[model samples]
Target: MTGVVGALVEAWDELRIHRLRVLLALIGVAVAVAAITAVTAAVDMLSQAMREQNERDSGRSVTLQVNAWPATAEAASTDTEAIAAQYDLALERYGIEYSSRTLYSPVPVRFPDGTRGVDMQAVDPDLGVINRIVPVQGRWFVDQDVDAFAPMLVVNEAFMQSLGLSDLSTHPTVLIGDTDPVRATIIGVTAQRWTGEMPSAFWLYDQFERWWHVDPQMGQPAPTLAVWVPTDQADALSERLARDVQLAAPGWQVDVYDNRMNGMSGLDGATRWIGLGFGVFALLLGGLGLVNISLVTVRYRIREIGIRRSFGATSARIFFGVMLESVVATLVAGFVGVAIAVAGLKAVPFDRLFGSALQDTPPFPVSAALVGLGAALAV
Candidate 1:
């Protein structure tokens, strides 16, 4: 330990004597390390945030969708009621929590200015756990009004803008399909949808039933049902549904997706390789700088080394002395690089790109710093 301390002291003395050279080498290493640290942190934050968002968007709480066909031929055999019961039972059997909803069609919406378009949706007030449509402005539909003739419309932000509607207080009137105009009130607006290649619009499902002339007891076919299952059990639940439920139409499809699966296929093996490539490049650059500094220091100290050798200094000691100098320089630069990276991350706005995950944590990677220090010593 004393020998190591002495070597470190000597290395520091030599570094102080050649302050300019040390600073230049330190700058190079700092740049490399800072770049690696910041990029890695940003990527890690982005990947995590995206995964969480995908899970939320996929409705991890409960499955959702409208049933197209009913189990019974009677007009009273609306599959909506039976399917909700099935979802409830399934959740109980698996010791999992769940919810469900029925979607209605597009209702004709008229703004205060009389501009109009079809706003599509239908929702179950009680069992909708996944994609719970919280009202931003007005209340969600109550059970008493489920069969009411009155239209209760929930317009999304984009739909509101397109129809020249400004505020929920405007008491916007909407026509359900070709039916008589029903005064639907604005209730809620959803947050912006997840980032993707597709464009998304927000709307209310409760008012869609009045406009589309759908009677829950009319026993009509539904277009689709969205279901949310626990990520771990998504595949198993989907398979069970497939084997147990007989579809009225042979071509009907059951699609299952979870949050983790979203954007996952796109990440691919190439992304890992790319990260490794950048890491390797950074290590190589840092190592090269250290090696160049070592060679120069050795060249300048040849006469000193020769004098020490004449005094019975071992080659092993000389080699260790040289390596120790390189390691000291690299470790110093590595720490500075870590500091710069942390400061720089604080100055940037990564929230829009990475969301709450980056906002909640520090961006430094301790392991990377250790690896960089080791690589510099090896070089």
Candidate 2:
């Protein structure tokens, strides 16, 4: 232990005396370490954001939609309600929290100014799964509104701007489904949705009775009935739904989109490979620096090393002393590099660059310390 301490002190002294050379080497090491940390940190943040977005887009619970026709047009149709109940039971049996909603095809809102586009979605008020819309403005619909003759509507930002409305709280009048222009208050704006299939819009299930207007609800020109389900159970639910639909109506097609399956699912394996490549490159660079620094120290301290050996110092001690100096210099550089990277990252608007997807990510971990220390010693 005393010998090790003596060697460490001597190594530290040597490193101090060659301050300029050590500093230059440290800078290279620090830069590499910092780069590694920054890249890894960014990747980690993005990965987490993708996961969260997936969860938000494709709920953690599984959902299934079934469109069944009544045996007779006048026979009180309870099949749709019954099938929904069965789905709910199956989900509960699987220990999955589930919710469902019945939607009308998106309704086209024709304003007096000739702005024609589909913007409204009618939904069940009680279903909690996908009913909660991230409101950028007012509030979601209440149960009473769903039953009212003239129900309230929630509009999106794009819809509001198109209608020449400045504030959503002003209760703007808009036309729905070729009906006479009815006045409904704008309750909320949707979070900027990037889906290519639908234009920006708001909820209006309370105001319009979509089922009453369309014949063979499935044959209607608009998309109706969206069900949200858990990611893991999405495939199973989709299969079950297909089977249910076939049993009920063989001519209708069932479609499913598991939000969890979107955006960079295959990238995990690619990212691991990329990370490994960078790590190997970093290791090689560190090793090269270590060899160079160690050789230089050994060459410069031939006389000192000889004297130490004469005084009973072993070759192992001399080698270790040189290695220790290199290790310390490299570690110091690594830490400095990590600090600079962290500070620099704060200056960039990462949220804007990556989108709202990663706005609330946690700070990068300090595990880079281990990497730094290990790389320095290896070098």
Candidate 3:
């Protein structure tokens, strides 16, 4: 141990003496490690951003969507209602924890100048959880929001702007319905899906039903139920749910499908491998450059090696001492590179890239730091 310590001290002293000569090589190592680590972290963040975006569009992972329609055109309106009731019954029978009923309908809203038609979604409270809905202002729907006397609304930025409002601090209210025009309160504002997105709003299913009834003759689509279940059980429950709904409403076409796509995970995996491939290529190029510089450094110290050989330094000790110099230099560079990568990750504009802030921003991956350090040691 003492001999190893002395050798390490000697190696460090040599590095200090020739620091200027090794500076360029150390910089190469640092840059290479930084590239590997930053690329790895960026890939992770980008993948997560994409996954969240997908979740917002579709429902969360492993969500089952149930839809039903009468097989014959002669089916009565009561049959449609029965089908909807059966969907709810199936959900209840399975004791599904996260479920929602979603319906899209266009409603007339009184703007400042005149009334305009606005697209609205009437959804149960669980839709917020199933769809990963995050409001930029105020809060998402809660169970109690259903019981409010006035209809509660969560509108997009464009919808809020249409009302000539910038924020929800004043508790804004807008007249809804073409004939009756029940005053509805805007409780929250969400970001527009894209720039110049048309005005849209969301309402509690019960409140929407109590106020504005959507008629099928008006070209409105029927409400569909979404139930979030475990991935392992999605296939099994899909068939069972479909069968149950079919049994509840005989002579109806009932279908239950997994709404969330499985492609996101595969896409993320591909991105990780591609990013790592490029990182590895960069590391190899940097390593080659560093090796050339180290060779020149060794030649420059040939005289020093000869003198140490005469002073009872064995060939094995001399070899290890020289090898230790590169190891120690790379170790120092690894630390500097990891620090730079961490800072870069924190500085990245995640919201701009992902279209929204990530609900769960991952911490700096320990694997990234390990990859950087491992590359340094290998070089």
Q: Compare the candidates by TM-score and give the number of the best one.
A: 3
Where model 1 places Cα greater than 4 Å from the true spot, the runs are 49-79, 98-104, 113-117, 123-154, 163-220, 223-227, 243-269, 351-379
Q: Superposing every Cα of model 3 onto the true structure, what RMSD results? A: 2.3
Q: Pull out the clashing pairs in model 2.
A: 61-229, 61-230, 62-229, 62-230, 63-228, 63-229, 122-205, 290-379
Candidate 2 on 226-247: residue-level lDDT in tens?
5665566678867766565445
Writing each residue's lDDT as its tens digit, candidate 3 over 1-379 gives 9999998998899889889867788888888899999999999888988887888888888888887766765543533676678777877888899988888899999999899999999999998888889899998899999999999999999998888899988989999999888999998888888878999999998898899887775644457889999988899889998888778776667788786566887899999999999999888887887799889878988998999999999999999999999999888888898899999889989888776889989889999999999988888
Ranking by TM-score: 3, 2, 1
- Model 2 TM: 0.74
Model 3 / residue 255 / CA error / Å = 1.5
lDDT of predicted model 2: 0.60
Give the C-alpha miss distance for residue 229 in model 3, angstroms: 1.7
Candidate 1 local distance difference test against the native: 0.57
Task: Give the range where candidate 2 is weakest over 10 consecutive residues by summed lDDT.
Answer: 215-224
TM-score of each: 0.71, 0.74, 0.91
Q: What C-alpha lDDT do the candidate models reach, one value each? A: 0.57, 0.60, 0.86
